[model samples]
Target: MIYNKRLILAHFWLAFALFGVAILLGEWQMFIRSPLHGWLRNADLYYRSVTAHGTVMGYVFPTLVAMGFGYFISEAALGQPLVGRRWAWAGYYMIIVGSVAAVVPVAMGLDSVLYTFYPPMIGNAFYYIGVVLVVVGSWVWVALMGINLYVWKRAHPGAPVPLAMFANVAGAYLWGWTAVGAALELLFQILPVALGFATTINAGLSRVLFSWTLHAIVYFWLMPAYIAFYTIVPRAIGGRLYSDSMARISFALFLVFAMPIGIHHLFADPEVGAGFKVVHSIFTAMVAVPTLLTVFTICASVEIAARLRGGKGLFGWVKALPWANPQMLALALSFVMLGFGGAGGLINMSYQLDSTIHNTQWVTGHFHLIFGGAIVIMYFALAYDLWPHLTGRALLNLRLVHWQLWLWFIGMIVLTFPWHYAGLLGMPRRMAFYDYTAPGMFAEGVSVVMSTIGGAMLVVSAALFLTVLIRNHSAARVDPEPFTFSRAVHEPVSLPWALNGLGLWLGLMIALTITNYGYPIVQLIMTPEGRVPPVFVGGKP
Candidate 1:
């Protein structure tokens, strides 16, 4: 039986529940922004919903899921019960309480500063405190993962750490440091102002500090999905991993490159220097290397699966692979989205091309495609794979799973493609509503309406996804096979210290971050002119 079943189930359930709510709110955002009728057609209510939706999805949902999944990995990969079981439970409750603390203020319309650190627009102090609690809870998980790995290594002496656990640890460390920038901004900066201990806030410094976090945090969210691609998909499709070492290198690269490169997000802001922006843009492109490596490795892994199924010649193996299987289908659909998302990302990361779509709907479309489309689809696949093991009840409806993934894929495309087009047409993002009746707005209006239909499909898909899981809860119990991950074709019996652990990579990440961010942040801090008096969103800042 899978270890710590109740805790695992709790994590997945909360994650999906929050996901469902966020999905509904997202649809509403799309509706209000479109020409369609919305129940609450108020701008304040729209921004409130946006704030809540972004906060839940960006912080609470992914962190909880990753923590839960990490706990599962500790047992499934390391063959030990969680080292800090009580701490695990404590962290769980911390997140629950934190989620409520953070979101309640948003619900009451006291905090509408949409998710990211939109400084100069401080909200209720509780909102900032709530998010910190959630991050601290995840840090507990990070500590536990590190402890488990250390304990296992001591006992085993020289064995290569399991690939799943190693990558999990990398992600845990990635998050540990990644949260620091935002944490600093909150505890030392935002909260003080939020509580009226300070009159002005360093809005520019806040953005720079948050830049240390925003991009890397997405990778932390992507870790579980990437881990599944490396460790789960091939096995589910009946093949071994392509290269164990390549997988390690890719993950290690992710650890090194992902954290220090988010300044590219601030390219348009005059407060950031051109040289720093260019350097960050270059490193931002470097982040793509790991994904490229992942695509190659996973494709090779899938090809082996197809070839083993007796497929001949060049592309015939694709036909031989199992499309009906949920994991395989999800992987296929995920790559399709990734291909499109990655193309847009190239434009986003470019020094020159970025200006054309800097604050436009293109940014919105690009992120949603990457996070909501490519990443979240894998989350669904990963959950589906684990459900039978977690609940000891099989998913009885494969057809529903297929349709749900297909709907998400279609909806994401229909939704994002138009936004990309409208961005090119010079439409701005992050606004509650636009003047659809104005000249030259026909295309943008039409695009919003189209994407709203797409958002509706996504809403239905989220509902159907929850239905599939909830149905499994009530299904009859069975002797589900014990959990295991895919093996590499050439699994290493022994490995170097760096590949087997996160220490070297963690040090490298910190050094690189210091190099990239140290001067700019110091400059921002030293320059008193960058400080802007706090502008309260729903109240006095």
Candidate 2:
């Protein structure tokens, strides 16, 4: 029943608004990659678009969603108002300013390093400063989540944190750790070169540092979606959560294992040794642990709902459940994409298999399916579920909402499936053009062009989604009951501190990251690596 209408609406609106823009940019980039008139055939514009597209998608949109959704969880799950209202507003404005500052430089072709740190190829100073501001703003939100949780615990000393809130804080801390590597690189190395304080940077070290942030950041984006899975989806399906304790363990496991596994991203890079890469690959596989746990728990919860509704016999429950409900449909679709994406990811975790697809379209397809298809479907569902509560407007028309979801799901599969095929056919990524007439490239040429149709489908889906949200304002209003999360079959009343509080997990996560990253980072710094001079983007010839 706790609702902070303006506060919640502000955060959600900004996040999705930027998401809309990023989607348009993404489709254009897709077209550019296609043989469809070569998408204007300008490399400068293409790289600019890539940087803008990646930055917003990777940093601005996801971070804001997490932050906004974190605020919503704080108030709703805790049965209290948020403690740091002014600070939250301050953080939002910082992100807004930073997003503009960061993206403007990208659009001007002055910061075309393309999202990840490629430090020996420095971009504009404003670009790095802008990103730093966004990170700092997110850090403020992280502090607020901690403060809110502590305040709640003080009032109810022995209680288990609500599952949603627990997951929220878990993600906050996870991101807090994840941002450090990027922050260090920008502060010490990239910024120095950009501002003319230093002329050379160790490119290997930049890649290593960015690798630390790279993979874990995906889990951070996935956090809100996963939160929707455990906390909201079961309730939407009219089922109680099967096991609250299991949910807690999954989130905790992600916190412990997600950060260390970033090394697996460096598997093809020479900066890290074979032993460390092997260790990281082993640890990276641990991600599947929590993922499997989640799959089991959610599927069980859905089965319970089906049986309660008088679903009879094996698999009949699937029919009894409400596929018409957007939340239900989104969960089913999200899981479908997750299956394909996760399987593709398993290839990357293997050192030899990873080498086969490194910097190829296959990796791009895997990323898009996982994040765009699986993760983003739930973001849509979460937004639909919360909009009514925030605006006191009834949810959008079921038909339109369902159609939007279906289009995105189908379009994503159509788009990414081809990328995987083209990649296997020796197609490289980040190119603005491809010669379709080249011998033996017929299949690859066909793949990229066909994917453009998928891109167009996604763009249409995005438009429909925005329409659904905007149309809700003029639609009839209802007196909404304050929203609620699902019940656990046995409510988590008193739980172990390790499951409820982040204190133990935080310490353990730090130790794991240090063990994984410490030696390579220090070696790259202390020893002489071949340092390269800055090639500033859009600089003088």
**Per-prediction TM-score, please?**
0.98, 0.98
Best by lDDT: 1
User: For residues 274-311, what per-residue lDDT tens digits would candidate 1 score against the true structure?
Assistant: 99999999999999999999999999999999999987
lDDT of 2 by residue, 27-106 (tens): 88888767677446467888888888889889988899899899999999998899989999999999989988998888
In model 2, the runs with Cα more than 4 Å from the true position are 39-41
Candidate 1 residue spans exceeding 4 A from truth:
38-41
Cα displacement (angstroms), candidate 2, residue 405, comes to 0.6
In model 2, what are the clashing residue pairs, if there are any?
A: none
Q: How does model 1 fare in lDDT?
A: 0.91
